[model samples]
Target: MGTMAALVFALLAVNILLGSYTVTIPDFFAMLGGKTIPGASFIVMENKLPQALLGMLAGASFGVAGAVFQTMLRNPLASPDIIGISYGASATAVAAVVLFGVRGAGVSVAAIIGALLVALVITALARRRGGTGLILIGIGAAAFMQAVVTFLMSRADVSNAQELMVWLTGSLNSANWERVGLLTIALVVLAPFVAVGSRELRGLSLGGDTAAGLGFNVPRARLLLTILGVLLAALPTAAAGPIAFVAFLSGPIAKRLNGGAASLPLSGLVGAAIVLAAHFVAVNAIPGTSLPVGVVTGALGAPFLLWLLIYTNRANQGG
Candidate 1:
């Protein structure tokens, strides 16, 4: 609990300090309180503050969702990003923006539908096999979705294409209080359900038969968790357009940090830290450009994925 609180505080502080423009902590706080500090007000109020808030929420949501999926499947590779949920969300959102002329809440709804569809497909394909088979099928679905996104990009007009490209890469540059509010509502409403189900989740880790023997409704519990996980992934992807690998890495990283607590709250905090840290680095590290936060995370996450695969292989061979 102490570590999670400290990490959250540090992430909030870092996000406030490091942006395209600079502001002292005091002035930033003052502006946030509506104290109109001349030139600093717009930078702090209109831009950086909202972006930071959204980034933290989005990151935390992705992290929690990833942890839930991994725990439910008893597979480290089970994540929305890995299982094609993010791609589904992104593709649907892009299609809405380009073809249906949708935005705001409508886009989010579309993205959710897309994510559910892809999840259903993956589930169907993997029904006959185990967790490993599910993961392989998910990977294939993700590849196909990515191909569709690329094709859409190729056909878009230049101006729209530029915007779509930025969104496709995943960015928080356009984040505002509205996005923050939406995510907050989601977290408040859904997070508790996940929290309440922690015991059932732990039972699941022991395998379906064991869980059933222990008087848990394994299928019903799994369904509920899947819904929760999908909402967590889909909401953030709708808000931020698939901000790569925060979901994929947060669970394992948190487990490593906390010596495997298996607590969703702890994992969620670590996820917030990873996302906030990455966004801070992206905005500050590149002065003029302010590269997409997703790019930074993806670059880091891709390598981590490779390491995980190698580690898993070695563990399998050793056993």
Candidate 2:
């Protein structure tokens, strides 16, 4: 935990000061102190600070949410991105922006509604079918939602489509204090549920029958945890569009680090690190071009996904 905290702080520093226009530490502090420091003030205050803060908060949210789902489901492939929540949020947000002409809070509202609705439907369908069924249904729903998003984008005029694409790609270009505040408030509100429910979550890993035998109300706990996970995923998606795979990658990485135990807080720290690192690479890895943070994460996550598949198959086959 200490290590993760230190790494997060270090990444936060790197994210803030190492952007397009570098700001010296003294200059950054000076700007913060109300002393105007040429471009440093605008760049640090208006752009990099908000971006770094949002990245930390949103990454933590995604991390915890992903850990919750993966732990509950006992499936590494059960991240919100794979299961359709992210797609659902993205589909509705795109619809609101392109079709209904919604902006800001309306778009955020639509994303939350979309994610919840999809989660509810999937839960309803999977009630009797178990975790594997839930994952399969979520995959199908994700594909359907992706189709909807693609179709919507296709119908928009080129300019509109380009603008919408930015959101879909999950850029932090428009980060502001308002977004940081909302995400922070959400994390604060959601933390207690995770704290209270973690015991039930650990029991859940022992299977439903065992969890019930252990005095956990398996269904009620699962429902609450599911709701918590969805909200965690949704707020970040609403704030920064769906930053791809932070949720998916964070849990397994954290689990490995913790010697195979699921730790929500550590998972969140890993999530923050992944996002900050991805953003850094996105803006700086290529010499000339800056891609959306999602683009970089997607690139990083795809190879990991493939490796997971190969590893899982080999383990199953006892190879």
Q: What RMSD, rounded to one decimal, does every model reach? A: 1.5, 1.4
Query: What's model 1's TM-score?
Result: 0.96
Task: Give candidate 2's error at residue 203 in angstroms.
Answer: 1.5
* List of clashing residue pairs for candidate 2: none
Residues 1-319 of candidate 2 have per-residue lDDT tens digits of 8999999999999988886678788988888889987767887898889998998888999999999999999999899998999889999988988898888778778988899999998989988898989999999999999999999999888887987788788877778898888788878988899897787789998888999999999989998998889988988998888999999999999999999999999999999999998888887877777778999889988999899889989999999
lDDT of each candidate versus the true structure: 0.85, 0.89
Q: What lDDT does model 1 reach? A: 0.85
TM-score of each model, in listed order: 0.96, 0.96
Question: lDDT by residue for model 1 over 1-319, one digit each (tens)?
Answer: 6978697888887777755567887887677677997777877787787888888898888988898889889888999999888898888888887787787899889889988888888988999888888889999999999998888888777987898887778789889888889989988999679786677788998899999999999988988888888888999888877988999998888777777756677778877887888888888786677888999999999999999899999999995
